[model samples]
Target: MFPTPIARTSSGTQIAYKIALPVALVLWLLPLIAVALTSVRSAGDITAGNYWGWPTSFNLLANYTAIFENTPIGKYILNSFKVTIPTVIGSVALSCMTGFALAVYKFRANLIVFFMFVAGNFVPFQILMVPVRDLTLNMGIYNTTAGLALFHIAFQTGFCTLFMRNFIKAMPFELIEAARVEGVSEIKIFWYVVLPLMKPAIAALSVLIFTFIWNDYFWATVLTQGADTQPITAGLYSLNGQWVAAWHLVSAGSIVAALPPVLMFFLMQRHFIAGLTLGAVK
Candidate 1:
């Protein structure tokens, strides 16, 4: 049961919704607007503690250039890409295989195995920090991009599998049966039939996982160190000075750090919406 459409609601209710929507939207975007404004602020304005006031002089180009020239933000962004791209590909690939198996096959312990993946999602990752750190250290991968990417793939697969499994299960299973009657092999059926149908879901999930891993600061801090391995999320701290926190440069870096995921979402927006709404009706 969906909520009543606003058009059919009472005039009072419709007016209330109209009034509340923009208010709530502005409230949500206030911090982001502040950050954008701060990014263009001059150091003189920052030194004067004029955080919320109109800019004395805009240093948009200067501040953006300074972060790149003065810090290892470029390397940090490269490292973020190194970690995030591989994690997205690996996690989604593994999940698709696991989801296909779980959705298409009937087997003893199927639910048990599916539950194992589902159960991992409920475990608070904070508890795994110490052990995971020790494991990565023991494996001599504590501060490497590969180690971080692999760890993310392992951790993210659980939720990805859950998402993919439900989507796959919602599909018509009779297609697989039709493929079988035509003497198609299982692998071909999956490759030709199922994979095409999965493009929207893959695009949507890639955007989701890219955002998740790209903006990840916790594990980025815990598992990696130094600009050589640190993603932009964690490396933004380097923009701060010892005697002074360079809020302007930090804000600029934040904006720069956000571009990839935002661009990714926009590029995949059509597929993303299609994937999410595919089965919502009927």
Candidate 2:
């Protein structure tokens, strides 16, 4: 049997590393952990200034149930799903076509078009904010889930196109060439050849986009109103105002709002990582 390689570190160094790891993790997760703990506390506990202490009684279920029963949280969550799901599907579909066009074809102004997308992706949202809002209003979709989702799809398309183009560019060109020589149509090559290889990228972009759209308070507030149409992020802000010193309920609401993206990350972790690191290998 081969000898097992041993890691060598001084006791002092090992102790220092061990001490640092927990400290770093605690610092990174302090806000989230605090919110999670606060979610289970009773109103009296918070009133007694026991924000950081163990809960006097677990009220997690109560807090969550209260928000759903008393507030528009259910509507907000449904609106989020309405806006998020369609945006993901639409943006991905648009980007796939755009990316394929840019990657597979050697047309004039190709680099210029690609750079435009990259630049647009980095532009401040504020610059587009006013115009996009006006456009949505004119389209008669303002203050609606469809309006919010339409803007998200267009804006997110810039980044998605950049990602998809780069991903497709890194794929083997010979595959496309072989298919073309066999008289396969360009559309078929994309459907059968390119799309099959895009699973990881698709998964990664889906989760990432879902998180981005889900957490979008700024646009949600600006583009939509009323709990009937607003997403959970904006809904949370509104709830915070109403809850006042009810920290437990607020914390519970925050946790509930954050759960979908967290679950998505955990479930699709492999695809997420592969998608994120698409161009890192070369």
Question: Candidate 1: lDDT over CA atoms?
Answer: 0.88
Candidate 2 has its poorest 10 consecutive residues by lDDT at: 1-10
TM-score between candidate 2 and the true structure? 0.93
RMSD of each: 3.0, 3.2
Residue-wise C-alpha lDDT for candidate 1, range 52-120, written one tens digit per residue: 888988999999998888789999999999999999999999999888899889999889989999999
Q: Write the per-residue lDDT of candidate 2 for residues 1-282, one digit (tens) a residue.
A: 244222366777778878998999999999999999998888899999998878899987888898899999999899999999999999999999999999999989999998898899899889989999999999999999999999999889988999899888889999999999999999999999999998877878898888888888889989998888999999999999999999988999999999998998899888777766767887
Cα displacement (Å) at residue 82, model 1: 0.3
Best TM-score among the predictions, by candidate number: 2
Error of 1 at 111 (Å): 0.5
Deviation in Å, model 1, residue 8 alpha carbon: 7.7
Question: Can you give the lDDT of residue 15 in candidate 1?
Answer: 97
Model 2 RMSD in angstroms = 3.2
lDDT of 1 at 103: 88
